[model samples]
Target: MDTQLIRRRMARYVEMVDAGDIDGILGLYADDAVIEDPVGTPALVGLQAIARFYREGLGRTEASAQLTGPVRVAGNGCAAMPMRVDLMWNGEPCSLHVIDVMEFDDKGRIRSMKAYWGELNVERRPE
Candidate 1:
C-alpha cells in the first residue's frame, strides 16, 4: 500500500466528513474497518457499526473539523494529522484539538482510525 495514496484518500475522507456526507465518508473505509474514539466506547468494528457510531456520535451534532497541518505518513500505510473541531454542542460552543491516525489495508481502504483528544468542554455564549 502506498502511504501517499493513503494520505490523499484520508484528506478526501476528511473533506467529505466536514461536508456531512456520511455515505461519502464511509466509502473510504473497508467493510471491516474499526474506529476508536477517545471520548467514546471501545473499538467500533465493521461498516454497520461504524456507520451507526458516526451517525449517533458526530451526526447528531452540528460540528465541523479542519485539519490543522499536513498529514504525516508512517510505515504500513499509516498516516496522522492534527485537527481542530469547532461546533455547537448542547447549545454551547466548543472547540477541540485532536490527532487522528489512520491505517490502510492492502486494498487502500482504511482499516482502522483512532482519535486522541482531551475531554470536550462546552461553553455558553454571552449575550
Candidate 2:
C-alpha cells in the first residue's frame, strides 16, 4: 500500500465533500468501511450505515467543509488532514476544526475514518 496513493485518494474524497458531491464522497470508502464521527454515538459501519449517518448529519444540515492543509501520510496506509467545518446545527450556526484520520485497506480504499474535534458551540444565526 503506497501512502502517496492513499493520500491522493483521500484528497479526492475531501474535494468531493467540498463540492457537495455526496455520492462521489461516499464512493471513496470500501463497502465495509467504518466511520467514527465526533457527533455520532456508535461507529457507523458499512456503506449503508455510513450513508445514513452522513445523510442525517451532513446532508440534512446546511454545512460546508474544506481541507485546511495537505494530507500527511504516515507510510502505513494511514493519513490525516485538518479540516474546517461550517454548518448549522439545531437551528444554530457552528464552526468546527477537526482532524480526520483515515486508514486504507490493501486495495487502496478507505477502510476506516475517525474525526477528532472539540465540542461545537451552538449559536442562533444572526437575523
Candidate 3:
C-alpha cells in the first residue's frame, strides 16, 4: 500500500469524526472490519456493530477530534495517529488524548482499527 494513501485516509478519519459524518466514517472501513477503540475492550466487528458504536458515542453531541501530530505510516498497510477527542461524555464535556492505529485491506479500506487510550489520558474540557 502507498504510504501517501494511508496518510490521507488516516487524516480523513479525523476529519469525518469532527464533522459527525457517520456514513462517511463507515465508508472508511471494509464490510468485515473490526474496531477496538481504547483496546482491551471487546472488539466491535463488522459495519453493523461499528455503526452502533459510532452512533452511541456521537449521539447528537458536538464531538470532534484533531490530530496532534503527523500520521505515522508503515509500508505494511498500517498507520497510526495521535489525536485529541473532545466530546460530551455522561453529560460532561471532556477530552481524551488518544493514539489510534489502523490497518488497511488490499482495497484500501480500513480492515482493523485499535485505539490506545486510558483514563489517565482523559481530562475535563471547559464548555
Clashes of each: 0, 0, 0
**Global lDDT of each candidate:** 0.82, 0.81, 0.93
TM-score of each candidate? 0.87, 0.86, 0.96
Cα miss at 44, model 1 (Å)?
0.6
Error (Å) of candidate 2 at residue 12 is 1.5
Q: Which one wins by TM-score: 2 or 3?
A: 3
lDDT of 2 at 78: 92
Model 2: ten consecutive residues of lowest lDDT: 118-127
Give residue 81's error in model 3 in angstroms: 0.3
What candidate 1 gets wrong by more than 4 Å, as runs, is 120-127
Ranking by TM-score: 3, 1, 2
User: What are the runs in model 3 whose C-alpha is more than 4 Å off?
Assistant: none
Residue by residue across 24-77, what tens digits does model 1's lDDT show? 888999999989987365998999999998888678887777888999998768
The candidate, 1 or 3, that scores higher on lDDT is 3
